[model samples]
Target: MSKLADNLNTILQRIKELSELNQTSVRLIAISKTKPVEDIIELYHAGQRYFGENYVDELEKKSNDNLILTQCSDIRWHFVGHLQSNKINRILTRVPNLDCIQTIDSIELADRLNNNLQKQSKILNILIQINTSNEQQKSGIEQKDFLSLYEHIKLNCTQLICQGLMTIGSLDNVNTEDESDFQVLIQCRKELCDKYNFSINDIELSMGMSNDYERAIQVGSTIVRVGSLIFGVRH
Candidate 1:
């Protein structure tokens, strides 16, 4: 078997084990940012459906295949990056099966998504991006400001659906401490759900990356984005 196959087997085994312990099914999004389409195809052949991409251009190009493009539809393609307002229309035009836009931080961006969706007559699933590390330079709303934004999206926007929350943790230690951010993110999700009385079944918490996915599973990440571990490191 190829190394990719071996790596996949290992990750699946870990997911199964973690699921049993946590009593929660773990969804693995093979983070394919900067990776070749062939590598994603290899994993797709292995029965992996959910994939995450960081760049709009690259994601749209590769998504020309059987891959799902948008962040809300039948198949799952997560826009797990710092999204700008300029890119919203392109995303809506191309990727149809895009599952969730996981990095929405500002109301302007949210309004843009809503407007674009209305123009297209579609409803896009979204997650509010939280800066769990309190990093000013990061692309997320601080925890304190998330509730009002959530309320606004829920009440005003007909084309955008607020599914849950997403965040990128401070990558202090790739192996051990990285899960800290995911844990905090999970708390933020639960708090928001409680505040808004959002249904837990429909709510999602998209946190975790290649380095700390196992820990993310333990802490309750519905979607874990694994890039280097699955697609091999970008050059």
Candidate 2:
């Protein structure tokens, strides 16, 4: 097997092992930001279906690229970076087979996503990005604001699916056993599930990354975004 495939297998095995202990079913979103389409094709051949991009244009070009269009017919693209209000239209209409937007932070952004999706006659899955660490630089809604944003999306954004919550953990917490951010997200999920009258399992948590995914799963993470460890350093 190629190194990319080998690395992917390693991560998959680790996630399986870790998830078994926690009784959590985990999905891996391979972070493909700044990486080449060849890398995506290689991993796709290696059994990776969900890939994430940070830039709107990059995702648009990649998802429509001839290589990608021909090769990765079923690949699911995820927007995992900071989404600008202006780029909402670009991402919604162009990127084919787009799966989820994991960085929505506010009701305004949710409103934009809903409006654009409605124009396209589509409904896209989304994860409300939560500022679990309360870092100034991070682009996520605060825990207190999360409920209102979620409620708005649930009630108003009919074209958007409230798939779950996503968080980019603080850099200070990476590689550490601290699951404080995960705890904050758990509380966020529980609150929404209680208010909306749904099972907690109906909502998913998109947390963890190459640096601290194992720890994240120990607490409870349904989706882990891994990049360098699987695709090597970004190009």
Number of the top-ranking candidate, with TM-score as the measure? 2
Off by over 4 Å in 2: none
Off by over 4 Å in 1: 65-75, 173-179, 199-202
Error of 2 at 77 (Å): 0.4
Q: Scored by Cα lDDT, where does model 1 land? A: 0.79
Highest lDDT among the candidates is held by which one? 2
Model 1, 63-125: lDDT tens digits are 876443332224468898888788988998987568778888888888889988888798888
Compared with the true structure, model 1 gives a TM-score of 0.90
- Give the alpha carbon lDDT tens digit for every residue of 1-235 in model 2: 9999999999999999999998779999999888888999999999999999889989999999999999889999999999999999888888999899999998889998898888879999999999999999889999999988887887899998889999999879876888889999998999998988988889999999999888888888999999999988855
